[model samples]
Target chain A: MNTSKPAAGKAPAGGGRETARRARTRERLLDAAYRQFCEHGINGTSIEAITDDAGFTRGAFYSNFASKEELFLALTERENRARLETLRDRFDEVVAPLGRVAGKPDPELIEGAIADILAVQPDNRQWCLLNSEFKLLAMREPQVAPRFLESVRTFQQELAAMVDTALASVGLRFSVDSGHLTRLLLDHFESAMQEAILAGAEDAERAVRDNVMRTLPSLVHSLTEVRPPGS
Target chain B: MNTSKPAAGKAPAGGGRETARRARTRERLLDAAYRQFCEHGINGTSIEAITDDAGFTRGAFYSNFASKEELFLALTERENRARLETLRDRFDEVVAPLGRVAGKPDPELIEGAIADILAVQPDNRQWCLLNSEFKLLAMREPQVAPRFLESVRTFQQELAAMVDTALASVGLRFSVDSGHLTRLLLDHFESAMQEAILAGAEDAERAVRDNVMRTLPSLVHSLTEVRPPGS
Candidate 1:
């Protein structure tokens, strides 16, 4: 068996031209859907709007994806992967010996991660904004709700692991509960991002920066206090 | 000077049965709108859906509110007032000593407020649900964003004032970044509410209880610990 995959743009399956055409159509749908969702919200924008925006007939939409809900799932996965990649890149650059703040938690490390998240560019903003709206849409619609819930739980767990590692390395730790605190951190950052997107002006970034700096210290202290457990 | 003017349900200056009927129709419109917005989201369901649900002509939609956005503003005010009232009630019940645990911040006060917000029955879920969605809606459209921002700022200030008073009563004589902390707490709780709504099967309230309980001790310690400004 030839395990090595062909290079990009090479068709591996039975459908060559059809696969290429489907890929282009799929991108078109996602692009159109994202813009529509941003403008009118995920639940508000219809398949008609998506197809119209993509300049494709309804058949093109049905051929590319089964339904609007399917497209939303695809968008969520696509955006989540992109966001994780962005965070991973930033996290890679933040490595240090905990430097001068060796004994205590590095306020710099935590704040830097937060600032890095805040610093992702405008293109990422649209994806984030769309993903958020998709989450809200899924919450109300029973049809799409289950898939979103699973993905969110997975992300929350991943965040929890990162928090757990950070706390352990800092030599301080949550005495009573670790998982709860991690969830709080995730929730806080998500809320901050949603607020910034809504605020939309240049000042939006400042709001996220200020929020991260303010709340993160308390979280760090709570996690890594190194104080006696019962004190 | 008929300063009393006319009741909401009463006939207006021209004082006719038609005026009274219009009032009923309008109230129905508002109720139906808030209900739909909560269930389907602000952008999800259309004017036709709202009108049909309310059993009113689509023309009647204009008769009541200027636009969907205007109706959303009304929903925002109603929800804000309702939430604030509930918060005030929780505070009233906290008393002084019972509000604080020996080694913790007065999170009983904060916890009670959250409990009040979270203890909604299935019937009342709409207000909480709609409140979250329209809050985001308020942020996306600049015209409606101020009302939501104002509501959040007001709640944040209220929490700060509550904390200040609690500290005074306990004779803790401490302060730290009240404004920033206030925003953090508000963001934390609001985000928690959003998660609770989404995590339909999971007991989010339990997690919230844990999160608040864990954070309270650090808050108290920070409050009691005093230091020289430049030391």
Candidate 2:
């Protein structure tokens, strides 16, 4: 309640130099905020620090975001949106190799493709740390919990739909509920990555890749190969 | 380098009223620190706040702990020890009924027992959040990384040994390396519990219980039942 209200005049001007400059400044602030939050965590960060890191003053930050909380929430929204887009792009990137084959793809090719699809990003540890912190805060803070969970559900639903679409492209589908399996896989992949990341081995990526490849192949195989005849 | 050195003259007196008093005071401080850390997190908490909450002064805190980091490390050791003890107790409690019965135990009964053993602890969300934060810090801070990962490895090894002993009690064993399976199962169970906890449903515990009971039974059955013909 002590936070500043949204600035009415902060909206981007239509097809003007001011709009382009405003957009650049906003992007720079978001980039800086992301790095700061990942490095120092949410509570350790401040509005002034974010603006300073972005080479801006308090006025610039206030014009772009109503408050630090508002900025963090916007970052979450942006990250989620970017994640969904990446999931789609990665799905296509992984599956494109299998398109060379005709009907019903070979299981090994599918496994490799899925493994590629699941490979850990280099900065995954940073992202996961910040994400878990946000999640913990959202769940514990009653005011934020409902909207946070709602957004989570929506994100999961969208991811599941994308998974279904990706599967359909290959004439495959989960014997289990697609959404449930997608959520489970997402959790499994993240947990494995977290363990490997924390372990901090020389081959951390390989640790994650190997685990995902080892476990998910059988899971995918069972889902596709063990379904009962149609009811 | 700015962190306090390990305190001198902090060692407990040899088995007397003095020693008992020191032990009691240490326990109180740790209890208060755990609550504070869970509520405010490690970085958000301070030595003064911990001492104040425990009804002690800075002199008392320094006499007991070298620094805040030292206190946090001690708390981690205590939590890990407590968790291992709980695992043992829960395993025994769940398996006690089965011991009373003769002949091959019912699969449903075994599944139920395993499910009970794997159920999320009541304070799981707080513990998981703190643990994640510790892991994140350990990964990012090179100076802390080695000791932290070593402790983690030791904990996992001990837990895997306990799992082996528990399974051997029933003439069961993991088909894969017990340590590998233990690591995988730990990740899976923790991830499921985290998801359910974050969902913040009215029946979050039940949601976690149902998911564990559903996914883990088949996993346990497969791992135990599908061993090689010889071993």
Candidate 3:
């Protein structure tokens, strides 16, 4: 209710320049708001805090985002999308060995994906700060919680699909419970991420990740056990 | 801090009766406090709300709990301990049938454990509520953050010890990263609990758990991979 309404401005030369400037201001506010929210939590954060961090006026904040809630929706969407792209790219970057290149996934590729998330994602302190604090912001504002969960679902589904495809191609699958394996893997990644976030390198997230790759061979073996007649 | 300090009073004639009554009062307050905290969060609920729920007065709240922070810490410890006991007892109850006696775990034992947690623990809304909101409280006052992390660590270590003993008895030992595996398994249980608590069985939580006993065989097989003799 006490939020700005979107405007449909005329498409004039000055209007175009104003649109571009507005986009920049929005991006700045988003970045600053993200950091603040991650640290201080969403409710704990204020419009003034966001504007101050971004070095903009409160007018500019309202001009860019309708409300604090809308900004968070944007942040959740943006973060998930960006992280997904990064994960896929990490997978695509590995240069598999000549022999293994024909079929098996390069360990480097998978390991890199795990390592990259461990290295670059906000530290556990920030994540705990976010999880403990800011997640409430998403749930309190009805427009955000389901959408946020949907985004997570989309990611999980896509990742599951990718793993499913990989296993199928390799003649490895599980009829007993392929779905369970995929969910467990997703859960594994999330748990590892959380531990990595909280304990930092003391958990040696990267090292455990290396072990994760070794587990994959056993995974492939299990798949062989449960795969369809010809899969 | 006006909380009953464990031995706050003693009735001369019938100390046993007074002690029993006081113990019951403490338990009632804890139960009410937990329900309130789960719904509202540590910061969201107050002494007033707790007392109202527990059928006590403001003065009674003071008599039982020294401070809001102290109550919160106590509630957290109580719930976590209870959860561990629940998980452990469930595992113990199922071990003979699932692992040793059955030659391997059947779906029943594992499914039973998962189901018990879902049924016995707090509802989805409450758990998800904590998942969403507790992080903020943890961040604002990190003095207890270590304790939270320690709780998780202790759980994982205890689980690892149980796993180690189980595998040893079976003449199958964890050669892979047992620590990570323990963390991973515990994480799955917790994640499933949260999912059950949150959106309510939206993902593969049930399906995955249904075959937890079955899938675990293949998993344990994989974990037996030999680590090189000595690097």
Models 1 onward score TM values of 0.71, 0.75, 0.69
Extract clashing residue pairs from model 1: A44-B43, A172-A224
Question: Which fraction of the native contacts appears in each prediction?
Answer: 0.28, 0.27, 0.28
In model 1, chain B matches the true chain B with a TM-score of 0.65
CAPRI level of candidate 2? acceptable
Q: Is candidate 1 or candidate 2 better by lDDT?
A: 2
Query: Model 3, range A1-231, lDDT digits (tens) per residue?
Result: 756544556466667667788888888988999889876767789999999999999898887789887787677667667766665554333212212434444445445444554455433345444543434555454555566567656766776666556455444444445565666777776555554444444544464465455544344333334244653
How do the residues A31-139 of candidate 1 rate in per-residue lDDT, one tens digit apiece?
8998898888776899999999999999999987898889988877766666666655654344233332645555666566556656763454455566666766776
lDDT at B175, model 3: 53
Question: In terms of lDDT, which candidate is strongest?
Answer: 2
Best by TM-score: 2
Candidate 2 Cα errors over 4 Å, as ranges: A1-25, A52-64, A92-111, A119-122, A168-181, A200-207, A210-231, B1-23, B55-60, B92-111, B118-122, B171-181, B192-197, B200-207, B210-230
- Per-residue accuracy of model 1 over B28-129 as CA lDDT, tens digit each: 877888767766767787988889989988788886778888877766666566666665565444435433555444545445544543453223345556
* Best by the DockQ measure: 1
Model 1 alpha-carbon drift over 4 Å, by segment:
A1-32, A43-64, A95-100, A105-113, A120-124, A166-178, A197-200, A218-222, A226-231, B1-66, B98-124, B172-178, B202-231
Per-model B-chain TM-score: 0.65, 0.81, 0.66
Mark the 10 consecutive residues where model 1 chain A has the least summed lDDT.
A91-100
B96 in model 2: Cα distance from truth in Å?
7.2
Q: Give the candidates in order of lDDT, highest first.
A: 2, 1, 3
TM-score of chain A of 3: 0.66
Q: Higher-DockQ candidate among 2 and 3?
A: 3
Candidate 3: what lDDT? 0.59
